[model samples]
Target: MFCGIVAGEVRAFRVTDEPDGVAFLDTRPVFKGHVLVVPRAHLVTLADLPPESITGYFGLVRRLAVAVESGLGAGGTFVAMNNRVSQSVPHLHTHVVPRTKGDGLRGFFWPRTRYADDPDATSYAERIRSALAADPA
Candidate 1:
């Protein structure tokens, strides 16, 4: 889906198309002016992104953050990315959501669920710590 959009094979409201990346409107937007920025190359996650491309990739994100607010007359913008966990697309895409005062959009789509107790929280944290320890990268 993202590949088609980036290649112009799919229809999407285009924003900016540069060597760094491409920007376009999200089909299902949080707000009217929600846009998505994606790399031209097929990169699945931030860890897959080359170190040399980091600055360029985020530069485009920074530009869109400003443009969303100025162009849409929004109070602010919510820039987010989901890696493997909540990623809707296998291809990497950054969501640039326009924000305004009292828009009634609550933070985090999921319900506010808490751990059973501190022990449960500690166990979850340990799992992440062990994963990071094993990963040399």
Candidate 2:
């Protein structure tokens, strides 16, 4: 689905394009200037990507993070990716989101408002911790 974006055949609000990957403004973004860096070749997950391709692909992601932060005057950037679990597209892409202090983002992809208070938050954390402790792997 996203290979078209890398080939320039798919029109998007482009940020930068390099041999390694393509960086473009996400059509559905959490904020303005949000960019998705996609590898030129179609790789379903990060594990599917060749090890040598890592630096080059991620280099563009790093640069776009800076651009999203400085160009948009954001306090910082949130860089992330979803593997097979939550991968929206079958292609690998990195998300670089512009962030401000009170943007209301909390856990990885969870909205801050999804939780209530400290007790509510503690309950969630405890469950995860218990699961981690029980895991044999």
Candidate 3:
């Protein structure tokens, strides 16, 4: 993790001007366009982020939801933070997942399946990237 280094790891789907931040659909998403909004800052959870940072973080999440809905044709989106049970990687990040009726995503009610191959992963990533780029906040 690149603490205080803004740009973070992936540059492909970066949305905002914050250097230590980026967002895009997860390569192995739970659904077709499941997006992750992460800060480049190396923090364990949202509680570790400053108030202003948290505010900006969620603002980006909202922008991502709109982009996913308009550009990717998702019926709606889900914004979530897993501070306790599902905190993987120990970073202060949020998920903006696009959802549709009968998409079979049970949210936190059921476990998520990981993608099996690179090609499928790449396709989902590209789809969200294009959508985000076309309608960036």
The local distance difference test score of each candidate is 0.74, 0.69, 0.67
If both were scored by lDDT, which would come out higher, candidate 1 or candidate 2? 1
Clashing pairs in 2: none
Q: What are the TM-scores, per candidate, against the unseen true structure?
A: 0.78, 0.76, 0.73
Per-candidate clash tally: 0, 0, 4
lDDT of 1: 0.74
Tens digit of per-residue lDDT, candidate 3, span 12-80:
333344553677546546666677778766777777888878667777777778877876688998888
Give the better candidate number (1 or 2) by TM-score: 1
- The global Cα lDDT (0 to 1) of model 3 is 0.67
User: Model 1, range 71-112, lDDT digits (tens) per residue?
Assistant: 656799889999999898998989887788988778777222
Give the Å shift of residue 48 in candidate 1: 0.7
TM-score of candidate 2 versus the correct structure, residues matched by position: 0.76
Question: Sorted by TM-score, highest first, which candidate order results?
Answer: 1, 2, 3
For this target, which candidate reaches the highest lDDT against the unseen true structure?
A: 1
Model 2 residue runs over 4 Å out of place are 109-137
